[model samples]
Target: MGDIALTTLGQDIMARLDEAARFSEPGPGVTRFFLTPEHRQVADLVRRWMEEAGLAVHMDAAGTVVGRLEGPAPDAPTLIVGSHVDTVREGGKYDGMLGVVMPIVCAQEIRRSGTALPYALEIVAFGDEEGARFPTTLIGSRALSGLFDPATLDLADRAGVTLGQAFADFGLDPAGIPALKRDPEKTLGYVEVHIEQGPVLEAEDLPVGVVTAITGIERHTVAFTGKASHAGTTPMETRRDALAGAAQAIAAVERIARETDDLVGTVGSILMEPNVINVIPARCELGVELRSPERGIRETARRTVLESCEEIARARGLGFEHTLGYEEDGAACSPRIVAALKEAVEADGYRPRELFSGAGHDGLAMSALTDIGMLFVRCRDGLSHHPDEHIAEEDADAGARVLLSFLTRFGTPRP
Candidate 1:
């Protein structure tokens, strides 16, 4: 098949992105969190678009919106395309929305060109991927994969509203969450289209990126406890300062990450107790995320950080504790899907390279029980999750074309 005409695809993609960006509009950014009114509105907008594209749409019990395009042969497993719609606080428009919209655009293009695939195509917009408002990630996909449990309902937001309560407020039944499981035999494969969220593709000047694997993520909360001292009374050498110890540990973690190849450690969030200028900090809390394409490297870096924390705490006469934040089982992309995408990218007159995704995605959860792959469009300035995050319109269209080409080869015969 010929490459998708950029003029048509670009206009459509831009329009959709613009529309989705208007939902939360929290200051110059977006903030459509789980089960919030803005999120519901955006989801509703997605459903309307799905129907407008002539796909049959339905919402599963767990609140994932699935849009289906039937193929000539009815007896076949479905090729799934999706990403989350939830955005982090003051996030960008394209981060997770592109993953869902690209599939829709592909379906529309295939319909326009009269292209037929062997299997039915299903586009899913997963809810609550960022977990910004709640503690659950991949809630929609996990529920479909039978991973969401009764305890998931107990998770509350800052306002103390439970996930189940949010579901109720959204006019969905809380008890029906577990019924969201899909027929395992019917899902043939999965694909996610997203912005690179890094400088990789932009640096390479590539049109699209074929993801080889999703990075393993290890998140932890490190707490350092030391004596609170009067700033004026305690000598600099005599003070047992928790904040000082935490700063040293954070510095060590950053240095270790820099030394380790392909490993990333972010100590983005920190809290100091008893905000007083005079006292030596009694306790300091830090949230850290460690990521690496290789599990060994990630594990080594993580272990080193914990060990360093213990050493620093002991040296400073402090108490230390580590709590796991979020641990996603690492997912390597499906070779078959990646091969298909690479071929498609080549067919579109672009070179293909194998790259690992540094960020966690909903695809990681879906990959547990289904074959999955991801496509990354170049991000301007190698940035994402910010209001300034961007991808060229042509790149958006090209990524969709790559996804269409791959989905054209996806799925297996229902037996």
Candidate 2:
């Protein structure tokens, strides 16, 4: 693609994204959630775009929209590219929507140019990634990965409507969800184009980067219990204050992260008893989360942090306990796909940069279905899930051209 054509392609994609943003509820920012009327309209609009691009389109039982383009050869494994279409409470336009439109435009260009491909192509727009509607997230992609738990259908939204009911309202059968999983033998791999959602690419002055891995995450709760006493009566040297022990643990958490490389630990929430300032706090509960691309590093950091907390509690004469709430193992990008994406970016006349994804994405769930690869375009100031989130037109052009080149040269299987 020429420079002028690339700009035009980017402009078209941005315009489409702007159109999608219009379906949001009346609010400060985009607030479209899964199973809402807004989601239905947006899915229809995306399906229309896919049809216009000369692909067969359908909305799966999970409300995920997919478009298919067949290759010349029969029985060839299909190449899959996609991202989620659902948004957070006030998400920006480029977060998940960009990935969907980028490939649609590229597939349209390939159709117009009559280009040949080594395999079939499928573009997917996943629904329900943000968990904006229900207590669960990633329902669409997880279903594709055979990770969807059927019990989640019993879960209800704020309106008390069950997921199964929502499916019925959308004219889909809940029983069909299990069949949405694609066979690995007939699939090539999955590719996603997403905003960096962080400052790494912008700081490095690169428009795009190859995703090395989606960082694994572990969350645990730490609670300390001590005898409550009158603040005025308790002496500083004699009191066993749980809040004081928790304070030390929180500080250690920060220091632990600062001392470690590529590791982030956060104590996002704290709840302590004895609301009155006149009384010493008897118990304190904290929510801690740790993330890192390397499992061993993350696990080690987690153990050290927890052990430090326990030691602080023992020193303060407080009962200490912790429980691992949830854990998701990290998913490394396929070496083959990573090399191809890096090569694609290098072909676009810039240095290829590699980084790990700090945020969760559909790619993490889809990794179970097939080999996964991701390309990240830089967002301004690392802002995402906010109205101010943005990417430059030139950056979009770079991402588009790189992806265009990637799809064009993906590979040919031997007869």
Candidate 3:
């Protein structure tokens, strides 16, 4: 595509992104979760765009909206491209939206050129990747990979609605989820385009990069229990405060993360029983999360953090409990797809840089089903999941050009 054409396509993508932002809930920033009314509206809009691009569109039982453009041969394997459409509460506009919009624009541009590749192309707008509404992430892609647990159907949201009930409310049959699974034999690979949620690309002064692997994640809920005491009457040395133990644990998490290379841990949430200025808390609940690119290192960090929490509680004379909530192994990009992405980036007149993704993406789950590759577009200050997240039109254009280049040259079958 010519520079002028690329510019026009970039503008179109931005316009569509703005349109999708309108479907968000009432807030200072965007917030659209799984199977909600906002999700349905976004799905309908994407389906229309897919149709206009001359691709056949369908919504699977998992609420994934897929747009298919068949290859010349009917039995040829397919190359899937897409990202999640769901957003975190008060999230930025470009995080997942760019991935979905850029691919649709690529497909439309390819169709206009009247060219067909050896493999079919499919664009998927995943229904739930944030897990903002529910507690589980990658619900859409995991279902496609046949990794979704049936027990999750019974999981309920804050509104007391089960996932199965949510599916029914959305006019989808939960029993049909099995049929949505893709055959690995028939899939070439999965490619995702997304904004770099960190500052590395910007620091390197690069607009695009190839992702090497996604970080592994482990989450837990920790509780510290202690006897309540009068805040004014209790002597400082005699107090066995649950909140004090929790504060030490939180500090330990930060200290560990800072000491370990490529390891990041967070104590994102904390709750205290009898949360008052005048009362010493009887109990404290905390949410702990750890992520690292290396599985062994991540596990070690988790263990260390848990051990520190226990020590803090024991020293403070408080009871402690740690319960594992969720875990996902880090996923490495396929070497074959990585080579293709590097070539695409080089062909686009920029030196290809390889980096690890700090945040989780649909590609992490899809890697179990097919080889996965990711193209990262630089965002301002490496910021994402916030209203301030941003990407320049030139950067978006560069990303689209790379995707077009990759599609044009990718012809080898999955071995």
Ranking by lDDT: 3, 2, 1
**lDDT (10s digit) by residue, model 2, range 1-415:** 2343555778878888899999898887788888889999899999999998899999999999999999777887889998988899888999899999999989988988899888899999998888889999989898888888999999999999999999899888879989988899988899999999999999999999999999999999999998899889889988989998999999999999889988889999999997578888899999999999899989899989988998999899999999999999889999999999998898889899999999988888889989999999999999999988899888887899899999988874424
Structural similarity to truth (TM-score) of each candidate: 0.87, 0.96, 0.87
Supply candidate 3's per-residue lDDT for 384: 86
Predicted structure 3: lDDT: 0.91
Pairs clashing in candidate 3?
Answer: none
Total clashing pairs for each candidate = 0, 0, 0
In candidate 1, the residue pairs with backbone N, CA or C atoms under 3 Å apart (3 or more residues apart, or in different chains) clash, namely none
TM-score of 3: 0.87
| lDDT computed for candidate 2 | 0.90
Which ranges in model 2 have alpha carbons more than 4 Å from their true place? 1-7, 413-415
Worst 10 residues of 3 by lDDT: 1-10
For TM-score, candidate 2 versus 3, the one ahead is: 2
Q: Pick the candidate with the highest TM-score.
A: 2
